[model samples]
Target: MARIRIDLPEHFAFSTTITLLLSHINYGNHLDNAQLLGVVSEARLRFLKSMGYSELDVEGVGIIVADAALQYRSEAFHGETMKVEMSATEFHDFGCDLVWRMSEAGSGREVARGKTGIVFFDYRSRSKVTVPAGFRGHFA
Candidate 1:
């Protein structure tokens, strides 16, 4: 068996805080694995919104998550405020990886970290498209 490791960037370009709800907890009384990804998804939306874009419209194309990887570090309990930080990295012709980290808001205890590989797509044409220069420029 092997463990997944996520190497985070030194500085994140965007961040947001989300508080865990009872529904986010599982029978273990901590954050559920699946819910953690949900949290990340919310953070992703915030990151894009900050850049004045959305998953459905980045420049002229939409984005689809091609894959995802996560490394869990600690249990997160309900009512805990999580500080999620995100940055774009691993750029390619069509897209890039949105890397992020999640930690307890005040304690700074890392709960999880991961990256989602996103690919730009022309929904109407039903095909992948090259990354938008305008979108890439924000991170450059």
Candidate 2:
């Protein structure tokens, strides 16, 4: 199995926490792979919403995931509170890559780490757009 690793810059910050339930578990008794993604997605939305923006809020200069990869280091069982941390590692003209690190809330040991590449898009114009100045400034 791959090891969980993340080295975030000091300027950027992103994080959220969530609890697992029986529904989040798979037949094998650990957190399901699909549900893991959903948990991270929820945290991402909540984090963005806290900043007064959302997936829909940035419609004109919104972003969509162009690629994503997740590496599981350990199983997260039901009822465990998992803390997910996200941050931008690379920012470019058209998009950025966000890294996610998940760990057990009690021990602080990472359980999984992942990254997603998001590309900006203008839904109304239906074309790729450059990263907005406001959004880019946050990572810098």
Candidate 3:
């Protein structure tokens, strides 16, 4: 099987630091693969909030993640602070790709690279919607 490859962007527009907790570790005593995604989700939320939006409400239209990919580069242990950086890219008519890079805080050692494809939607109509103008203007 071929693994997904993600090439990180040159610059990240936003970043947040999160500590890996004991619960984030697996039996192997390192950051679990599944929990890493949750950490990234938290970073995404912080990024959206900084822009005055949320996962369920971005400029009047909500968003749903259509796809996601992650490439883990190094192990993360409990009690370590990770710096998660995020950026928006690959814009389409109705959605965009959110890129992420995770590394050891202060050390700059890369831990992972990832991307999530998200599409705007109207919760009331239960249909996919176009990207909001305000959202694009602010983040694009």
Best-performing candidate as measured by TM-score: 1
Ranking by lDDT: 1, 3, 2
| lDDT at residue 58 of model 2 (Cα atoms) | 54
lDDT of 1 by residue, 64-138 (tens): 999999999999999999999999999999999999999999999999999999999999999999999999999
Clashing pairs in 2: none
Tell me how far the alpha carbon of residue 108 in candidate 3 is from the true structure, in angstroms, after superposition. Answer: 0.8
The sequence of per-residue lDDT tens digits that candidate 3 reaches over residues 30-133 is: 99999999999999999999999998899788899999999999999999999999999888999999999999997899999999999999999999999888
lDDT winner between candidates 2 and 3: 3
Decreasing TM-score order of the candidates: 1, 3, 2
Runs in model 1 lying further than 4 Å from the true structure: none
lDDT of 2 at 18: 94
Model 3 earns a TM-score of 0.96
* Candidate 2 local lDDT, residue 121: 86
TM-score of model 1 (CA atoms): 0.98
Q: What is the TM-score of each candidate against the true structure?
A: 0.98, 0.88, 0.96
lDDT of 1: 0.96
Q: What would the TM-score be for candidate 2 when compared with the true structure?
A: 0.88
